[model samples]
Target: MIKIEQIFNKKDLELFSTEEKNILVNVILEKADVSKRERKLDIFLLSEDVLTEQILRKINQIISYYLPQTMSVSIHCDKLEGENKGQRLVTKAWKGLLQCLFTEIPACRIWMLNSRWELKKDCLNIYLEPSGIEFLKGHKICSIIENYFIKLGYPLKVVFQEKTEAETYDVYEEEREIIESILKENEFRNTETNINALSPNIIGRIISGNPVPIGNSIKGTGEIILSGEIFDVKKRELKNKTTMLTFGLTDYTGSVAVKIFLSGEKKSLEYRFKEGLWLKIRGKIEKNRYTQEYEVIPFDVNINEKLERMDTNPEKRVELHLHTRYSSLDALCSPTEVLKIAKKWGHKTVAFTDHGVLQAFPEIYKASKKIGIKPIYGLEAYIFDDESPVMILPPDKPIKDVTFVVVDIETTGLCFDDDEIIEIGAVKILNYEIVDRFSGFIKPKRPIPTNIINLTGITNETVKSAPPIERVLPAFMEFLDDGVFVAHNAEFDAGFIRREASRLGISFDNKILDTLALSRIVFFKLKNHRLNTLAKELNIKMGSHHRAVDDANTDAHILQELLSRINEVGISNLSQINDIYQLRKGVNNLNSYHATILVKNSTG
Candidate 1:
């Protein structure tokens, strides 16, 4: 079935989609044999069971796209199966990962090209040059890379390993030495008295004026004094036999490029103009003609190494609200690293209120629990509640006397004719307390979709050992009792149950109460009424979101909270609860706020 020629023919393939690149990343170069004119490679990849046939085809296509034309290439793809597949993907993808890194972060260049990486057990051990390690540690870059791959749909770790002597290389040696020997043959007299004499004291006298911060220096800021550390230095030889040394300078406020033409200097700026060295310069900001960008030209340079410091206040401060990578452009830090830093900084508790979604909670839970910090789950939700309330209640009964059955269900799929119910969970509440519970899994006719299996962790094997929906539904219907049919979204759960009952020619009718409707009116100030959002706001323990029992149990808890709020406002019965649904008119209801809600204890 595989087309061998198109794959083997040398086709220039510089373009690839994100998904295609990820295919390249999750492969290991098991073997590579290269001759003068040809190259052969053996790559290990996920088995066809783990990846679909379409995905496997795409992976082969990506292999063809990435291999160079210089060699007559042959690649043998070998499939890996079982538990070790994860480790294989992690270990093999490091080379392709650099490409992903560059695409995600523009500043992540080819500095890590020759670095060594391997996945041992769970951690991705990376061996980088010393400077590369410093840069990674400074920016907290490891977790970001890990999280990037996570969003690409796999879980892996990134940990920096000490570079052994064999693994180490001078990443900047070429840039520093290319124009170095030419500096010894100075056309002018030997200009150096002592390069070491150009210290802070002498440099202070040379300018004697406050240095303009590099970030604030604009083009045409003529002959101003500036101070910063050199970060990047590169040397380029021109056709005219002149040498150019360009280095990036930063003062923490901003950064700028400083250019120097090495025509007659006696000493190499490689000694002073190199990366990580601090310098004070008298330079004029001018636009470069070739690159068409503003840069600096130095008049005089001196060593000015400023002492580094950090504020180590040991006071424990509580971080109530923060955002993670889920908060759009607001935050990019991975929750794992951010929570770890919070614990390191003596914060015992923290909360993440990502914008309008509870999708980040799972990551927060896993990360914080690992680091011994309390995670107060919350969100900045979008609220738009202006719907009329639906109330079907016993006319004169007080709230305490009536029993409420809060029900939740998990299904094979959404359609009534096609999909069938797989699981049912229900909780009975009376006198504001959960009095009883019912839970069961029902086998469906069709196979469960892969996504549903992931979301609920329920498999065909799990239901195969259980009863069918025809048998399970009757018991669930009987468990509903004469109580009011209650659910988070009553239209879905109760309606689906009713639809199934109609097939059996059985009458299914109960006074239905929608907790979703109650939440909208009761918590009108909330951004939106998601189950997790309502749970976070009301401080209820939502056990597991997509599961039947957890959601139904949580719905019962929300009902109690809504009932309490209703009673405080003088609503005595279910009919009066609907009166609260009328919009709070004449007020500026259009405006909404990003609120900070927190969990008080472990249950939350």
Candidate 2:
């Protein structure tokens, strides 16, 4: 597997410390998948992550350095467009043929593992490197490779030659000014990856090197080393009275079981192969003829430590939320391992907010107490807070006559304390009708961040000539007169208004309704309660999401849709908004989501 980051050593991965290269290697191999039958080394990933093209080619070059010239390689991205280009080159008939040659003939294993084949009407051309040509000299592998296919009713002369290098690799040489040259021509990249850091001597010589991800072990390949935690070990007495340990190994990507017969001194080490112990095993992924499933046949087992990510940030961010195994069906991370790492990173506090289960609390307390960190106990509780009055300053006259002003505000940032409201958009919904609309942009105290500008398309240039906050705030307050305040997340929009008013010494209080809160009970089965999600659910035509006018209009439709179904949840008047959810029944009805409440002080 090519670690493009290491070969090219891009700035993207330069943050990893000198000592953390092992962790980087582990992370890289985690994404690699190899399928020999398909002749593909698919590093298919679509994340905001970077691996330099040159580094990738060099890393790949390193992987094939020891392999035969028969393995011509090139890198191609199969993203947004999809991986429709065919990868399968050799047919099923070519399986046992390659495996037999690999195990018996050293020359074939070194040169022919990834042999390129060009099947023509007249003959089959097999490209090997010049060295591979010499390795095959005086060896009968070419005749064996070709004759095996001929016996399968395919007659064609097998021609072997040096493979043509892809044009992509040649382009890599042109970019050597900024990027360090990773590999010289016909040379290997550094083979000192962290995968084999703690390789203890096993068998005779050290059985360690690159460990292929279990997901991409290039099925039926020999010398496949899988490094990860081992578990589910079962010891049974063999017919010869020797002990055999059958256990499963998982690198988090995939899992495979290994059945190893221990002899003499090795029998005493049965307990060492149990759960929670991470081990790197060198072996072969062999398929069982009867069961038709692949399993590992171990040759050497070495003690290995799973790489724990370390936070290099001087001011580390607080891990306010985490889920343990008790979270149910979603996480395998236990409280001990999580807190151990958090404590190691010098985090003062850690919180366990598992999904609705306090079963993890007892364990969380013990772990945090032992680790000398404050533990905030909480869960992603269901939405059923009767104590939280739904409508703030309820008008007490919202049975049907009260108008609802569905308002949305785009701000400079999240917190209303310091962040300013840049724009305000509102729609008046009188008895399910969009009777009026209001939209305004206000100049902020500071320039908008580049990312926010990109996200909302709200630039300083657009708002520079617009009215300042002093003028826009008063107009918005007048437009929002007496109507029940409504927004997707009413608190966020309403809070900004309150803050702006308070700053100017204006008394601002209104009847507030959260369409977000309403959607939870009204459309309880909805996967999420986002504004766009609700609008889409109701088939509403929405404008640009971040724009004030369009989002307010869309949120207005969402509010009306929720209002139509409010009776289903027994919520009618603004006063009865609190009754939308009744404790026990409400919790039992809705699905759980991931959230957390961290108590940092004595007030909690």
Candidate 3:
């Protein structure tokens, strides 16, 4: 499927023509059951013609009828041109159709797979949970999905996987009242250590030690909170008289099989394991004794609560960069919850800027009006746009096209002239909130100095097997792509990267912003502008001071805070801010190295 971001951009319209747009509009009108006054329509079409640059204009034109002015229309098209197009479209359509069905169908449980649609000529592969399989077998669910595709001119050859023992079911409508009554009778005991009380890095640092990047296998206990949809659960009676249950949790990061062992009689708790439920769990992490594979043994879990409706107030200022729980492990707010909190804080306009993916858009859009807030939809995308370095959205518009990637690097020494980067970390921010992260460990030719190792906790042994800087530069630069380069002390980090890129025969020229410079201008009352100091002043969490990812994350938050302050002072446009900063250069002439000297004195 085309990325939602690509489809939303007005530039995508250039692909379609006037005639094609007219054809698409006429065809859609003839087929769709839409109200005359309906301002928004998201149409996903499978076209018979191969969509080339020549024909893309029509689709663009058709989509243009609903613009940011009147109503928002997002159209995604899959051309029925390739030999596998029919199968691919069928699979894609079913995945979405099944997700929609789960919302409407009662007593139905489905474990939506993260697997991409697998298409081979005429065959398409899909899988359903046991309840979903049974529901389909009895209710002609296949026919409903098939008919929807048929209307769009495609006959599907679906290869649904056979139901497995672990395929779970949901609480029946009859069972809900009973379970609710039982839960009401025995209220939850509040734990002293709630999620909010824990440090932001506790899961990654104290509990499990930085979350093993999803997909990499490891052994031993890893205490962490994983957020994902509960897809399946399998109950087994072990020879030792303990009941072992394994559940599948999936997120954009990946999937994991979490197993919990129950001793004594606790079968009543089984009802809590509902399919399609979104949960964040905290508990013991241990490796499977036999298999040596890792699994989380969750002791406590929190199911997300529904957001309450609130009245609107038009005078509230907009929060352009805010993240929801969907931003992997980095954020603690869900789309609805973020809006609810924003509403409680008296904000009328907020942006839903989840990293890379736009999965949060649908939920945020639905919750916006109910919560009395207007959501500006945008993404913190990672793209390489070197040729065109400057792209800013108009100040009066809802959003700017420009993106910023806040970066930080840890090196063997201070001076870029002689120092080598040991690690580089950055996060992409769109509309001001962190969306995606890039982390790479570089193996420098020189051994890391003892003082540097003591500071960064990166020993010479750490990067022994890691890729060299030259090998990592290409991908790192690619991830940097076409965004505005931002750093707390922009000159230090960006300058190092530029120096390295020059050595590697790569051109590295993207506009750079120094939060240090911006902070001195915005918060002139402060005696100093260090990342940790600014973070403390703004009340944003700083995980690890010297680490690349943590510093980058903090820098992103500081940038968000600065933007909020800047907007309040009547500076809204990125271009305008850049121009002002150009005039304000040397006002403080601060560098991170200077701040580090102060930090050393304090520590000493």
Better of 2 and 3 by lDDT: 2
Ranking by lDDT: 1, 2, 3
Best by lDDT: 1
User: Could you give candidate 2's per-residue lDDT for residues 1-604 as a string of tens digits?
Assistant: 2233444335444545553444334222214466687665645332122445654554556445423332445544422222321112233334556666766785566577535556666466777766787677558777876665554333467778786553112222122321121112101211332223333533223554878788777467455788877777766553444455667888877888776655555455565666888777776566644234577766556777796657989997777777789978968998888888888898877777888788987788787888887777767765544455556656556556778888988888897668888889999988678899999999987877657776788977788898988899888888888788888878788888888899888777777888776677767777787877878888998879888888999988887777777655666676776666662235433444444665556775
> Each candidate's lDDT (Cα)?
0.68, 0.65, 0.62
TM-score of each: 0.41, 0.42, 0.32
Candidate 1, superposed: residue stretches over 4 Å from native: 1-387, 392-396, 414-417, 582-604
Q: Per-residue CA lDDT of candidate 1, range 1-604, in tens? A: 1122223323312344455444544443433555654455444433323444555555456554454332444445666666777665554554456656666664645446536566776677877767678777676679777875574346677888766554323324233432343333232223544434345432112555678766666656467788888887876554444556778888888888886656533224445566888888775677643233577766556677674533277776766678888888888878898787777677777778888778888998888778998888887765544444557544567888888899999997777667788899999999888899999999887777767887988877688789887888888878887888898878888778998899887678888898887776667687778899999997888887899989999988999888888788888786676777553442233335556666565554
In model 2, which residue pairs have backbone atoms overlapping below 3 Å? Answer: 68-110, 68-111
- In TM-score terms, candidate 1 sits at 0.41
- Tell me how many residue pairs clash in candidate 1: 3
Residue 323's C-alpha lDDT in candidate 1? Answer: 83
Q: Which residue pairs collide, candidate 1?
A: 356-380, 382-527, 383-527
